[model samples]
Target: MIEVAAAIIENEQGEILIARRKKDKSQGGLWEFPGGKLEPDESVEACLKRELREEMNIEIQPYESFGVNEHDYGSVHIRLFAYKATFVRGEIVLVDHDRVEWVRPKALKAYEFAPADVKFVELLERE
Candidate 1:
């Protein structure tokens, strides 16, 4: 299984940040948390920070693990580690995703997300 890390970022307005997948990429046109696969021997928190820097061009302080979910996308199997984080610094410059947006948690369900990310969304809705 591919080990991946994802960020659950919240803004001062109580909105959650979600990124849209690039149209030409796998899982294209779907919304997902800003993160990527964990590198070899890297901790989840470290992986998340690295991914945010690379993908969003921002610094993040990941606090805790919110949850974990597993899913299969045909040939790809992923084990996702979701962490609650706070945006630290830098302007968000989308490199992997097409766009990024901060939305109220209640309204997050309106956007379609990857199957693996759907579970985390449901968990947030419960909070």
Candidate 2:
């Protein structure tokens, strides 16, 4: 199973960051809490930080665990670890994604998320 780390990054204005997958990638065109799979020997927090920097060109400080979800996509199974995070610095840049948005938690429901991210979205919407 792939171990993925997802960041529930919120800005000072209380808006959360979400990214749209590149159209050519797996689960493409869906919005997701920006993050990526963990690399070997990497801590969950480290993975989250690295992924946000590498994929989104932003710095973040991941905090407490938010939740976890396991999903199977036929070809792959992933265990997603969600963590609450705060944006630290840097301008946003899209690398692995097509677009990024800072949205209110309740407003997240309007976007279709990857199956693995649905649970996180639901929980955020309730906050």
* All candidates: TM-score: 0.97, 0.98
Q: Which digits, one per residue and each the tens of the lDDT, describe model 1 over residues 1-127?
A: 9999999998778888999999998899999998999989999999999999988899999998999999999899999999999888889898889889998888889999999999999999888
- Per residue, candidate 2 scores C-alpha lDDT tens digits across 1-127 of 9999999999999999999999999999999999999999998899999998898788999989998999999999999999999999999989889999999999999999999999999998887
User: Which 10 consecutive residues of model 2 have the lowest summed lDDT?
Assistant: 49-58
**Cα error of candidate 1 at position 27, Å:** 0.2
Instruction: Report, for all candidates in order, the number of backbone clashes.
Output: 0, 0
